[model samples]
Every structure is written in C-alpha cells, then in structure tokens.
Target: MLHRKNTKLINKLSTALFLAAITLSAPSHSKPVKNTSSPKKVVPAADLSAEDKLFVELREAAKVNDVAKTRTLGSKLESHDLSDYVLYYQIKPQIYDKGAQARVDSSADAAVEAFLKVNAGSAIADRLRNDWLLVLGKRKDWANFDREYVQFVLNDDTQVKCYAIQSRQAKGEDSKQLGHELKNILLDAQYFGEACPEAAQGIYRAGGLSKQEVAAMGRIALENNYEGLAKKFGVDDPIADTVKKARTDPAQAFREFEKKEWRTGRENTAAAWGVIGQFLAKKLDRNAIKAYRLQHEAGHHQLLSPESQEWKVRTALREGDWRLVKESIEGMSPAIRKRDPAWTYWYGRAQKELGDEALAKETFQALIEQFNFYGQLAREDLGMKIHVPKRVIPDESLVKQMSENKGFARAVRFYDMGLRFEGNREWNWELRTLSDKQLIAAAEHAKRIGLYDRAVNTADRTKAEHDFGLRYPTPFKESLSPIANSIGLDSNWAYGLIRQESRFIMAAKSSVGASGLMQVMPSTAKYVAKKIGMTNFKVSELDDMKTNLTLGSNYLNMVLQDLDGSFALASAAYNAGPSRPKLWREKLPRTVEGAIFAETIPFNETRGYVKNVLANASYYTALSSSKSPSLKQKLGMVSPKASVLSELP
Candidate 1:
C-alpha cells in the first residue's frame, strides 16, 4: 500500500507539472478583444502626456473599482500609467472601474479612495514610512485604515490623538489612561501576535497590567525558558496550579496533547518525553531503551493508526528494564518481523540470557546460516567454518538466537540494519517526501549502498521536480556553465546561490536595499562596478541574470581570495562582512570545527545566512542537471552549524 501510494503521487506530480508548464507558456486569451498588449498603448509612467495623465487618472479611477465612476474614468484615461504592476494587480480585482472582475465586494470609488488615503497619506507618502508599498503606490492611507480597524485611531471629535484615551479619568503616565491603553495593546500583540497588533502594542506600554491579564504573554515567556520574565510579571501567580502541575507531572502534560489542547500539547509532550527519555537514557544501559526505540523505529505498525503496536512498543521500551525486552520484542506485529531483524536477534539473546539453551540452539543455527550478519558470532557458537546458507530460517524467533551467537552474520546484519532499520523502523525520516536537495542526497546514499532501485526512484523524483533540472528559455548551460567552470564551482552550487539570493525571482528586493538575483545593495554594486571598471550600471540591472551572476560571482571570488581560498571562510565573509571570520576564528574553539561560532557570529541573520548558503550549495551540487560538483569533498566539514572549516579553500 505504501509503495502504491508513493507511485500514485509520482504520477500525479508529473501530470501537475505538465499542466503548469502548458499554462505558463500559453499566449494571452484576450489579445483581440481589446488588445492591451502593445508597448505604446501601455505607456510607461515616465512617458505619459497631460491628456494621457487625465486618461491615467480616469483609468486609475476605474481601477479604484468605483462602478459608478468606471465609465467616466475609463473614458477620460486614454494613456494612463499602468506600469505599476503590483498596484494594478491589487486594484484590478476590486475595480468596478466600469469593467474588470465579475464581482466586487464594495464600491470601487470608496474602496479606492480608502486604499489610497490609507496607503498614500502625507506621513506615509513622505520619507516617514519606509514601507515600499505605500511610498510607490500612494497607498499610505491603507496603514491608517489598518489602525482604524484596530480601533487605535482617534475619532475626529475625540481630542485624544496622542494621549491614551481608554482611561478618560486622567491624562498623565501616572493616570490609568496610559496603563489601560498600553496594557490592552501589549495584550493584543503578546497573546495574538500578528492577529492583534494594536492590542499587542497596548500591552507593551501597559507596564502596570496585572499578571493575570498577561497570562498569555507569561506563558509564551515561560515556554521559551524566560524564567526571569515569568517571575517579574507574576504570570505564575494566576495559573500557579497549572504551571506547578506541568512541572510536577509529565504524564499530565501528555494529557493536554491527548485532549487536543494544541497550544500546550507539543510543549508538554516535548518537556514530558524529554524528561522521560533523559531519565531512561541517562539512568539505564543501551539495551534498556532498545525495546522502546525499536517500537518507534522498527515496529511495522503503519503510521495511519500510530498509537497501535508502535505506541505500545514505545511505552514498554521506555521503562529502562531489560527484563521487559522479552515481552516488548515479542509483542510487535508479524509485519515487523520482515523489517526488524534486531527483534529476532535480540529475542534469541534474551532466551539465551534466560538459560533457554535448546531454544537458543535453534535460533543460533539460523543466525549463522540464514542471516549472514551473525556469521562469526554464529560460527563461534556452533564452532564451524563451512559453506554459506542460502536461506535457512523461516521463523523470526530463531533469528534472535543467531544474534546471541554474535558471529560474522550477526555483525553484518547489525551493520546493514544500522543504516536502514536502526531507528524506529517506521522510516519517518526515511527519504519519503524529501525536498529536492534531500532526495538527491538520499539517491547518492542509496547508490553508494548499491540500492539501485531506491536510488533511481529518488533521483527521478528530484529530476522532475527540481527547477535546477527543468527551467527553460534561459539556456541554463550557456548562462550558468561559465560561472561553474571559471571558479571550479558546481553548476548546482551556482544554482543554490542564485536560488537563495533570487529564487530565480529576478525582481526580489531586500530591506537592506539589496536588489535583484544576488541581492546586491546598490552602493555595493556601485563599488563593485568601480572596482571592476564596469560603467553605466544600476541596481535595477541586477534583475538581469547574466549581469547579477557576473557581479555576485566576482564578489564571491574576491571574498574567497581574502580568506586564502577556504570555502568556509569565504562563505562566512559573504555573510558577516569580510572581517568577521578572522575575529570569529580566534574566538571559536581550537578544534577543527570551531563551535564557538554560535557565539562569535554576532549577527543572527548572517550566521543563519552563511549556513543556508552552504546548505544550498550542497543541495545544488546534488541536483546536477548536467555534471554535479564533488559534494562529499566540498561538504567534508560536518555539523555545519557547529562551525567547521575544512582544509579546502
């Protein structure tokens, strides 16, 4: 059934991709109906004449979606600026504009004016509001409307524009007015996050609000391990019983999850099981949790009814009692017998340990003959070095005895199982539903193990889905190969960098003023232009893939050179400016992998940025639409977030 589902998904994905390709490449449906495709008819913003501007205003009026005004506005605007693609998209749907969408929720005139006033107010239109949507689109009034929606705005006759109006009694900070407004705002944002920003802001300022009112905030703080804040706010006082109960009893914590109390469900489970696992793992031997993990790992209970045998085995295993191993291993389903040889082997060991010699003998014989893994262990027990058994044992119970023998066959079986069935045999993290990067990696790993069928399946899945393999019209080979060849860079490495920087979404922009494919800030681009002797350049040009790649790669080459050619060093330089790597190098641990990077990489953005880029590079190489770069070599450094710099430059 599992294989069948996966196969069906594969076909569906193929069909979906085919449909998407056809739709995206097709021509417009209404070229003749009104033919709005010509470059001249759709004049750019800068090219509109006075009459055109009136036409533009009428079109804009039409776009505002005021149905009553659409006919009037559309006729007036003959050559209006329609180049503001984003605004056009937003307004088109609402436009009663005399004509556009089939249905509109409100009057276009009212909605448009509301949108314009909120988005394009003087405060928003001027340099005051740095938000791009308002500055360019005259949408400053939109933010005001948001404020109005939250009831945060002062009524025209209310005379409380700046002061807190909730508490009408007093006006000063000492007055309850400030406290009330502040608390409400703070509560809104703190409890509801994005859902209640105005209230969040109120809560932020209401420093005097009681802990009871701040329960949500306090809970968030406590969950994040903010004990100090919890204490200061007295959040524990109101729900002291719940908090104390959570700390005292973990099974109780799981009850929340069981009851579908999702807010605390995951938190409670993690905290509960974390404690349980810690208690057993630290207090017991390796064999203790073997029975437990085996259930989560190997028990063949399909995840559909997850609480079945898998849950049962897990519960039994966490006990840390080797005595229960017998019951636990035997209790697993028969299907598990196919997947979990460890269960068979361990059962035999248990029988032997219990002094069941006759049963152990039968089990060991099979372990030696049928299961090649317990070869030496089985051989040692039986005291023979003869021909191999093609397929000896039929029953899983005998396989356990073979493992107890601890021969070559046992070792080989253990080795093979470690890679596949070692963990909870459920294959939860097994290569299913993997990302493009992950699937490719899984494919390579499967290939290394000679699992050609699995590897090809994984590779084929990635091949169809990964944009690295299928993007067209831009002749990837022509545009990207040189970048790869020049710096001994892999095509995928380049692709990863490009993907992260631009998503192949050429119009992307960063808050820090970075532009286009590589997210190069205009100033930085200008600096590069000057350094590289390139003239007449603009940040807008970064939208061009060829231009962006050239500049971004050149800058990368420079950073690499600065770092004496170490990829790790170069990557760090790219993220944290060129100088931070040296400072971090010294502050970090002297081990081959400097783990102090978590502390030394001061900027969270850059630290994560470096990790993401490196991870992306590794993924890109695996995609290998043409020839992939040597990834194992490049990724030789382990636990990337651990801050390891390999010997390679």
Candidate 2:
C-alpha cells in the first residue's frame, strides 16, 4: 500500500527519528518466537547496529526502485538477523515492476529460488514467492507459476489468483472450475487490476464462460467505475458511454436511453439504468427511484450488481419509501441481504413499516449482539441499550512471550523506520495462529509500545475474550479532555475521532497532508488557528499534540453547532468537509433516523467514518462511565439542514 512517491517522505522521517532516538536491548532468542510476559524495550533505528541500519536503507531503496542502492545495502546485511528481508528487497525489483511489463533478470530466478529454499516456511520467503509468482504469471510461465503458487502460504492477492486461473486454463484444466473461480475473483471489482480482466477475457474466448456472464461482470466493474475493466470484457463501447453520460447528467442520459432501443439486449439496458440510478441516488435525486423502477419493470433487476441494488434501496431510504426499500432489498442476491447487517436491519425496518412485526422483531433480535453501529440501532429498536462485553485481562507471562517474538521485534523496527506496510505485514503474519489469550497479550504488548493502532486492531480480533481498555484506549486523555471540554465538544467523541483518524500515532500524516492525531488538513488547521485567535500559528505545529487536539476539537465543535448538534452530520462533515453534508441534508426528501442518514452518506469513506466515530464514541463512553451507553441518543435525528452556514473552512 505504500507507494513509491511516499517513500521519500517516509525515508526523511525515519532517518531523522532514527538519528534522534536510542535503541533498547531485546530478549535473547535463536529464532523469532511468539508471545511475552513483559514489554520488550523498543530499539530506535538510530541505535541499531550498522547492519540493521543497512537493512532499513535497503528496504527504503527497494521501495523506490533503487536497485543499485538496494543491492549494496542488502549485501552489507547478508549476515544480519533479518537477512532474508534484505535479500527479498534486493531481488524484488528484479522480478516485479509496478505498471511495467514483467522483466525478470536472468539471475533473479535462480537467486529467488535459492532464497525461497533457504527461508522456506517463513513469511519473508512466502512474500518472495508471491512476487516471483507474479512475474512468472505475467510471462505465462505456467511451469514456474504452478510450482511456486502451490507453496504460496497466503493466496490473498487478487492479481495472483487471476494469474493462477490463467495458468490452470493454459494446462487444459476443468473449465467449469476455472469459470467459477474467475467469477469470484472478478466480483472483487474494486481491486480488478489488469490480470483478472485478462483472465476473464481469456476464459470467455476459450468457451469457459458465456458472453452474458462476462457482460454481467463488466457491468459490475462499471458500477465500481472501472471503465478499463469494462472495456476488457467487451462491454464498454456503448454501455460505458451511456454510464459516463449518466454520471455527468443523469436526467438527460435517462431521456436519451428511453428514446433509444439497444442492440446490446435487455441486460446491458438494465445495467445502464442501474448505473444511472446509482449515480442519481448519491445525489439524493428522486429520478434515481424512477430509474430503478424502470429497471425492475423490465424484469432485469437481477442484472444489477449488489452495490447497485443497495443504492436502489438507499435512494428509497432517502425518500422514505419503505415499499421500494423492501422490494429493492429482495431483488439483491441472497448472499448480500443475508450477509450485510445493514441490509438486514433496513429490511426489518421496511417489514415493520409494512406491518410485518414478527419478521421485523426476528431481524432486530438477530443483530442485537453484533456490537456495531447497526447492531446498536437494532438493539435500541428492541428497547435495549448498548452493552459492553466484560474485559478479560491477559496474564503477564503471555505478554512477556509476545514481547520476545522476533516477528513483533521486526515489526517494531519497521514501525520505528516509518514503514507501516512492512510493519503491519510482519505483525499480522505473527497473529495468524494466536489464541484468544495470546491475542489479548499481543494487544497489550502493542499498547505498551505506543503502537496504539496495532493494539486496537489486535484486540478487535479476539473471538471469545474482550478488552475494552485495549480496544478503546484513551492515550492522551489528560490533554485531550480539557481541550474538548473547553471547546464545548464531547471528549468521548473527540477520542473516537482521534482513534479513527490516526490511531494515536503522533507523526501520522495522510496522503493529502492531514497530520497528527486528529488528521487535520493544513488548510483546515490554518482556518481553525485563525478562528481561535492563536496568533502566529505555524502549520508545522499541526503535528504538536496540544495544537492538533485544540484545533481539531474547535473545528468539530464549529461543525456540530452549524449542523444543529447532530453527531452523525458533524462527524460526516468532519470527514468530508462541512459543505458536502449540508448539500446531502438539503437534498433529503424528508427527515430520517440518524442511522438511515449515516447509511445513505454519498461518500463511502465518510459514511463508514461517521458510523465508526459514533460507534467508537459509544464504546468510549461505556468504558469511561461503566454504564450502558445510549447509541441512539448519541446518533439522534438527522433532518434537512436549516441553511444558515455562512463561513466554514
């Protein structure tokens, strides 16, 4: 996930931090082991030995495709403790080139094979195998790909899976099985990179899949705005053009569509309508309801993807059309309606509105114990409050065991060097086989090391035991609470936003320049500082704990006041600017429950952000007060905006 462009910034920060800090001694160990009793001392990269520094440099160099530098640094660290990773960095560029044709150096194959043989069963080796498989896959080297893929421990990459399917087809494998596998991979349209589309086309050409099936996949891709993918499936020439027109001017596109007869058949026609309806629904336009209605009337609702089907329901939710909501949800794939709690809850609400109380109650009961935003709302619908599971503490010996884990130590080293992608991969690889107790202990270790993000994520993975303290940590409560209180903002809400924004990482910086705990944009920070009368404020201070908390809290309070104190609206505004939420509220046909509004948020990120912030706030409140929290009270109602906002940055 870490891109080449960001490597420079990461390197600068890592280098400065390394030079400024000291390393602490680690426990003696032969091989990287699992779990610890006490917190292992963190070693700053600056204090690491020459070999360790070279390893970090090698990682940095490899990230930016500096092959020469990477090879030099890697050679120096060949005898280091984590030499495998160094070797991986050295060979990775030779096999994998992003956005370029796969060109494997002649020596890379043998070198990678040797490395994989030596570090077999290790995470680093598996990673190298994965990279090597990609190259082999691109070259249509089925012999190498088939061999390496069988040993690939984590078959999680979409592109890799697509390549495997291609390999299977090349070897005259069962068409039915390959088609089924290709369908599953193609359905993940958001990540539909080059490989999957190519495979789909190949499978279709080879009579493994039908034209209509491939077209449907293309439609799904178009629903996700993947025109390139749609083109690859041979569905873009006419349908993609209509979808593009619909995006720019839905009403006009609808008129044009109605006036024309398609040679592409009912499926493509329905797909176009579904896409138009999806775009219009995001704008809160009633025409979206009409578009979907036409699609349904044509008996082609089945053609719409799960996402488009959900948008049809969202459009109805904004219109308070319960009948349409029920109908749209019914048209969705059973897998979607049954799997997504949002749809189930909304379906229940629709049933209740249609006087089907028994069905509604059953649906609400099913979600009462889910412990999410929808689950909380479902519980409230059943006349109950949010319940926090009792905390389970891990033993000190377990914590000590986690601290001694070499994988975690490597993860910590990567984190110290600002390489979160590698750090997260290392941390998660170690967590694969951990028990509930071990998970809690790992989370505790992460918490002690100021890896709050890792701590929260690790605690969240526990299946049986729970720990609210680790899950909803209030790291800077002493400083954050006073600022929130002084600014008339709920401290719990601030904590939730901070937790979601930066996970308590003091030096966290977003892609768009939002910095520090609250992830405040530089522009927004400047505006807040000017408004709060903080003279001579510098943007550099946005990374300062006090400055970030103060400014972010003030901005949040401003949005809350401007938006009629609706937490859902204010939370959405905080994530997606103050103006967009106002536009969303103004376009609403009628007042709706806060949960409905949050669900219908146009921006996917903001929609999830609002729900998470509110949910996290509820948990924080419950943890702090030792009482059941009222999530409904926190969500309140979201009505049409009064339109009084004059200036908000």
Candidate 3:
C-alpha cells in the first residue's frame, strides 16, 4: 500500500513536470487549457519555436530511449541555460546501461565533465555529478572517484563519504585515519545503509572498531527498531533479538525474554527488559509501570539505557507521578540528561509539581540559556517576555543585485511557469553561496515577489541577525484573524499552526491531499464545513483563503473544546486526529504535566507538531501583543478524557 501510494505521488509529480514544461514553452499571455497536450491550436514540430521544438523533441527522444535521436535533438538545443540539462538526459541512460564497465565509466565521466564545464555552480549539475560519482564508486574507479570527489560541493552524501574513506584505504592510508572518519559517520544513525555498514566491516577487519563501538551501533539500531541492521553488524544476541520481538508483540516478547535462565549478564538482561518497557510505553500497555519497577527492583537500574529511562519517564508521566518522573530523569546518563531539553524542562516541571519551588526555578533559569522551544516555555514559567528579535531589513542595493542574478532569474521563471519544486531547487542552489546578509536580501526579494513561503524558508536558513518578521510573516491577516475570531480561537495560535502546516503557502497541497495554508484533509474539511452550516461547500473551496481559514479555525476550536481546552493536546489531536490523542490520553494513569504528556506522544510527527505549534504560537503571540505569552498556560495539565465518545470526526 505504501509503495502504491509513493508510485502514485511520483506519477503525479511527473505529470506536473510535463505540464510545467509545456507552460514554460508557451507565450506568457497564452491561456493554459484543461487538456495540456493536443491543444486546440497545436503548432507542428517543425513550425514550433526553436527552444520549444528542442525541448519537445528531446523529451520525446528520451521517452523512447532513442539515444541517437536524443543526441541529435540535444545538439540543436542552442546555447541556452537548459542545453547542459538536455545533454545530461541524453547521456544519463548510457551510464546505467548493462554495457562494458570501461565504456560505461567513460560515458559517465564525459557527462560529468561536460555538464560541469557548462552548468558550473548549478544544483542540477551537482546532482548529475553525484550520480556519476555513485557509478564510479560502484565500479571501484578510484582515480576518477578521487578527481570528482573533491569537486563535489555538497559532500552531504553518507555513501559518498564512505566511498571516500574506502578510496583513502585503497591508497594504503593508515586504518587510524580511516577509523576516525568512520566513527564520525557511524554515530549518525540516520544513515546506517550499505555504505556505512560496509565501511564498518572494513574498519572492523583492520582492528579499527572496538567491541563497545559495535555494540553501540547495534543498540542504536534496536532503539530505532531496525533489528536487521544489528544483525548485519554481527552484534546480535538474546537481548537484541528480544528487542526486535518486542517491537512486534510486547507481551509475547516479554514472556519469552524472561523464560531464559538468568546468568548471561546483568547489563544485557536489563537492556533486553528495557527494550520491552519502551515498547510497552509506545503501546501504552497496562503493565508498563509494573515491568519497569520489576527491572529496577532486580538492581539493574544502573544499566538502564537512555531509551529505557525515557520509557520509564513516560510510564511515570502517564500516572502523573511527579516523584517517579524526577527519578527516571535522574536515572538517565548525565550526557543524555544534559542534552535533551524536553527532559530538562520536564524535570523542572516535575520538581515544581512535587513542591520543590527553588530547585524548579533554578533548573528553568539554567535551561533558558538556549533560545529554543523549551526555553520559550521556561520563559513563560518565569514570567519573562518572549522577545521577537528585531527585524533585519535587507538593503535595497543587495536585494536589487540578487534580483538580477541569473540563478535568481531562472528560479523566478520556474515559479512563474508553475514548476514550484524545480523553482525551489534553483532558489536553494543559489542560496548555498550567499552569506547571511545576502540570504536576508534574497528573502526580501522573495517577499516582494509574493513567494511568502519561499521568503519564510529563505530567511529561516540564516544563522545570525535573526529576522522574526521574515520568519513569521502573516500573509493573510484580514482573512485569518476574522475567521479565528469568529470561532473564538487564538489568532496567534491559528496563524502559528498555519505557518508550520503550509508555511503560509495558500495554494499548497500536501502529499496526502491536505490542501491550502492550514493543510486540512479533504474529509475533515468537508465535515467541518457541513458542521459549520456551510451548505454549498465543495472540496475545491478548501484551497481558498477565506474558506480554508474558516473551516480550519472551526475544526481547531472544536478539538480544543473536545479535549477540555488544553492547547497542547488539541494541537496533537489536530495533527494526528481527534481519536488517537483521545485514546492516548485515556492510557494515562492520572493527570500529567502537559509538556511531559506532549513529549511522550507515541507518534513522532504529532509530538513535534504539538511542540512546534506551541512554540510558534508563543512567538506569534509575543509579536502580536508586544509582550510575552505563556507557553506554560497554553500547555496546562492534560488529564484523561472524561469518557470515551464513540462518535468521532
């Protein structure tokens, strides 16, 4: 089902790309017909304009894999910006052909060289070069790989980095240097794919990796539910095996885990039990707290991994046990405890909840040193203002200079032709070379061009000279505020969520079919529209500013009331659905601090959504009121729903 959905999305994007190309080829004043192809007055291929004819024939040739025709048509593409891309397409398939390796390598090298010669400093060229490098790495062509590797601007690919390490080792480099590089990439659990695993194996063979390093890698895999990865690294044991089983069926896994005679190792056994506890926390199993207590009672509390301690925190929070929450947090490794702001904030909240006022205030004061989501909440707790940084106005001269840049011009053209994704790539590629000041200038240009979402994102890339205005622009003020007001919703909160949901991209549609600034799903929109007495509502209306705002606000308000006016819970419900949050709340043994409840949310997406929305709302509120807003008040205690309501939205 997932594969089918992904394929459908790919087909949709492909169709959109084709339509965009046709649109771009046409005159500016021409009306786009419903049927893009075979339009009412189609021009003959010979009669088509030069650029249009080249593009059309080149696409047709590539579609049929007519390499000869592609090269012929591509040669006539003229000295234009797209010529290199056309040539790349002409050569791309040959690189992947099941021909002789030397021939394939030669073709790929030529393609990279030619493309870079013409389209130097372009994102498309970089992408093509990366693809070529992958082929070179696969074929073990170190000479070509070494030559191209240094020129790879992004250098962000883990696989490419792995190959580079492999290349160095092939050149008789010491294993110590190779091991140093491998260790850095190994810790990034996000990319434990073939390249890194192979690199790890190579490092292990050379005595570069220790037993603890291998186990740590395996632990990361188990924690992230990737058991096969642990197996691939040859770090498997009963504990790791039990962790995998727990992910699928916690009760069955636990029953089997405990049946073995105790004596393997205390730490290993506790680690296995901890994985089960984490699973139980995710499933909200009734026995989660009991299981955690049993593990602790067996004197293995010192061996509990960060994941195990995290679940212990969740299990305690479910019952609003402040003492246990503090204990669980304290039990975690100091490194883990110090790094996670969520845990830091919760520890303070737990102290406050348990009547340790001075300690709570001290914790929050220390935690507020970093300006982040939790810092905002800490400020709210301390009654301090949430300061929106002064807007940094870009200089007109710099903005003008960026406006006339060739890359910027091409990006704007792509956007004009409705190729948003392509336009974004072009825009970001240019941004890579810009300083913070230049990025701000480009953001101002994006705003002037009415690409508000692009403007927001462009400004967001800046690390210094914080510009809150560009980051949190209220594009549809008149429409959004009134709708929010009518529904008795917080205008700041409404806009905050909209900003995150769609980045204020009014016509944006999510991959899942949710549309407009609020990203309301079709069914949800329809239901809300009807409930609000919108008799003539259509799914199409969901993309309109007034309609989407009204419907989305109403739905938000409905969930807010349904969940007892707890904004954090309501925000989670808004993202995940009303039913899941409702069920998740019911899993709680008692009322828990709202921030703790939010951090413990099972769905990563919803947990992030809630936190970001609240944080955004805090900033937006500060911007609007010229005073601090209380994120603490927004995230009030979240008790379980009074009773389960069978009827749901």
TM-score of each: 0.34, 0.87, 0.79
Q: Which candidate is the best by TM-score?
A: 2
Q: What's the C-alpha lDDT at position 15 in model 3?
A: 28
Q: lDDT for every model? A: 0.40, 0.78, 0.72
Task: Encode model 3's per-residue lDDT on 1-649: one tens digit a residue.
Answer: 2322333333333323332332122112222123221112222245445675566556545433344566567656534345445665565544433221212233335445655655566677786677677777777789989998988988877778888888887887888778766765654455555556666667777887765555655676667766677667774454666767877898887777668727547666666677788788889887777667666655455445556777788787776678888987887766567667888888998899899999999999986755568888777777776677677779889999988877777777655544466578778888987888888898888888888888888888887676777778888898887788777799999988988898887877665788888899999988888888998999988878888888888998998988888898789988988888888888777777677778889887898898889888987887788566777778888776655673447
Clash counts per candidate, in order, are: 66, 10, 0
**The CA-based lDDT of model 1 is what?**
0.40
Candidate 2 off by > 4 Å:
1-57, 64-66, 76-81, 98-101, 104-107, 170-174, 205-208, 223-225, 234-238, 261-264, 335-339
How do all the candidates rank in terms of TM-score, highest first?
2, 3, 1
Q: What does candidate 2's lDDT look like per residue over 1-649, in tens digits?
A: 2222333343333323322331222122233232121123233366666766667667656654455566567556545555556667766656544322345432366566666766677677788787788788878889978889999988887888999999888888877778777875654577676678788788887888877677777877776677767777764345767777777787888788877735557777777788888888877777888888877666567557677878988888888889989988888866667767899889989999999999999988989878788888888888887878888987899999999897788788777666677788889999989998899999999999889999998998888788889989999888998888787788889898998999999888776789999999989988889999998999999979999988989999999998888999899999998888898888777888888889999888999999999999998998888678887788888788556564887
Candidate 1 lDDT over 1-649, as tens digits, reads 2322333333333323322322122122232222121111322255545654444444444333343343344333322222122232233433212232122232233333433343342211111122221211122234343344333221321112212233222223443444444333332111222212222234345554443444544443343344555554433443333444444443453344335434433333333333222223322223324323433333322211111233233333333233455665565444554453445554565577677867766776766543122332344445554232121112233324322322213223322322222111122224334565555554444344434333444444543233222221122458667875786654555555555565544555665667666677666677776676788887678778777777777777777766655566666776556666655544332323221232124454665555455545643444443443332244233122233343222
Model 1 lDDT at residue 445: 45
